[model samples]
Target: MHLRALPLDRAPVRLRQWVFLVDADERAAEAAFVALFAPGQDPGLGRALVADDGGGWLWERHQEFSTWTWFAFGPLGSELGFEAQPAETFFWLYGAPGEVFRGVEISVSAPEAQPPSEVALSRHIDLHRCVSCEVFDGAARIWTDFRLREGGTGRIHVANHSLAHDEVSRLVQTLLEIGNYRKLALIGFPPARELLAWLDGAEGRLASITSGLATGEDSQAVLDQLLALSAEVELRAAKNQFRRGATESYHRLTLDRLEALRERRVPGHSTMSEFIARRLLPAMRTREAADRRLDDLSVRIARSGDLLRTKLGLAQDRQNQETLRGMDASLQLQTKLQGLVEGLSIFAVGYYVLGLLGYLLKPWLHGWPGGAEIVLSGLVPLVLVVAAASLHRRKKRLIAGRD
Candidate 1:
């Protein structure tokens, strides 16, 4: 829904906004919205509802936070003050949902002939830490310390010179966004800081593992270490992915809103843009460095795994070569044994054949003496030749059939 300015009266308006960090449950946020509005009313992304007395509240739901802007026309000639209680106190009293992260009270008034003195501004804001500037091309002057009071709400006082109600509304909305998104962006800082030590340790461990791989450490042991480190890194990345991404997004939005203000410097005071940059940029840089470290660790772990795999592959190749050599030696021995067995078999068959011939010759030799002996002696070589030839032909047939 579009952002609409609060209905303006002759008197200036005072706006109070509370931003809450809600649970991830959409239904819970919706339930909270419905409780605040009419029954069965859905809390979409943005909604504006007004009361009969010309006062209303704007509601907006963000990724993990929601903002409630309440505005009412101020009385005539009212001085800038923080007499009202903080938004969190009121929410706590009425049981508002979610935890409050930021609260801002903005007072917009008609231009005055004289600007508030330092002492006067100090009554509401800490002048020592405040930012004062003219925004919207000098159409309005804004002053804020960006410091939370005892009640946990920041204060901003604006003096309108020639701006209409719509400009004022847009201005206030942008200002609120700057604060809300700035707080949301800082949420990643603590986790990022906590990860610094962890990242250091992980990097050192990875370096050691890499060195071991270089020095011919056990492949299986190195692989185990790499796997364990990779698991822990992946688990951490999965857990932090959402928050880190959100932080980056919110930080960008904060910068955009600050730029949109088109701020001009006030003498002796910093502009809102400068103030935020000074405070927020360092934290964002820290987060970016942490993310880079995580990525670097992942790459190193993958390289280590590749090294281990290569080492194992080479070892397996060597083992296969040894086994092949053993098989070759065994085959050579078997071939020699087969040749010896074939020669012995040929001799055995020849001896058996010669004896049978002699037995048959004994009956025929009844009429001859040396003739049988001579014939048998001559048959011995011929029988051996026939047996060798027969064995050789059978072996050739078997080999041919196999081929």
Candidate 2:
């Protein structure tokens, strides 16, 4: 949709279908072209090395979606709509090499937010509420038609559904003072009773559609749709405004840091070198802010997982140490049990040997007690050894537990 880009004093890029121009001085234009619309920076979709076809550049500097669109200048008074054929040698300028003019056409129509009735179509030219996808099936056109005329610096247009009387008038007045609009016009229907009075005050050919078939009429319905679309756009813009403030604050600090580093350019650290080292991270940070919030969140989650894993490892290590101590204690208990079994075998062997010796000595010691003494000596040594081993095992277990 071709509307005008008016001065800031006027309403900002208003409505769904309009264009406005910037009356930049040569220097301003040059600076804007150099700083904002650098060549090879594709304006559509993503970075695919686009060039300039500079009739004039549209530096769309919204808070979030910053972009530049280059256009080809046409002769004054040329028909400002789609043409069947495009001129071969249209003027073009671009930063990228081997990219000149490409023929594209633009069209503008009045707002027809709803299906036009037979009667309404007969009376007035049916304007589409906005451009459709069908219009740019091939290459798209850069639509710019609103320009300054009659020495009017800029123009402000309050759309057909614009309400808020005091606010609208204030904005209109601001647009006038700021040299924003060339011809400001408020297109709307006042309240019916007020509109009747307004129409009575109207001179020849009052420029308004005040009287209509109430809100149910197709035109009114279309107007409603357009206003709703415009409002949604405005709300999105308002939300972006807050984001822009935060972004600007962050970048402003970053640039300030860069300037400080530049001032401290040392013997070894070249300015370029410093920029490469310090500025690169911040630039990456900026890009991440714009495009990688989810990625950043993912990174944060991963870091959190790592921390948890570390904590779990520490706990697991402590549990393992306790397990090792328990195993050591169990080994000591098993060793003691084995030793006790061996000692029992040794005692049985000793008792059997002593018993056999007594049997042998019984006939020789018929009047002696040497056989009994031998048995008692062997048994006492065995009992003392068993008791000492048990005490040693209990002490070892106590030490292991303390350790």
User: Can you give the TM-score per candidate against the true fold?
Assistant: 0.86, 0.26
The best candidate by lDDT is 1
Writing each residue's lDDT as its tens digit, candidate 1 over 62-174 gives 66876777777664133464566454534432565777788888877754435666676678888777899999999888999987875578999887876764787788878
Compose the digit string of candidate 2's lDDT tens values, residues 255-358: 44333222322233233224333534444354334323323333433443354455557768999999999999999999999879866766675566556666
Instruction: Give the Å error, residue 57, model 2.
Output: 27
The lDDT per prediction is 0.80, 0.35
- Residue 363, candidate 2: C-alpha displacement in angstroms: 8.6
Off by over 4 Å in 2: 1-103, 106-290, 355-403
Quote the lDDT for 378 in model 2: 67
Global CA lDDT computed for model 2: 0.35
Root-mean-square deviation of each candidate, in angstroms? 3.4, 25.0
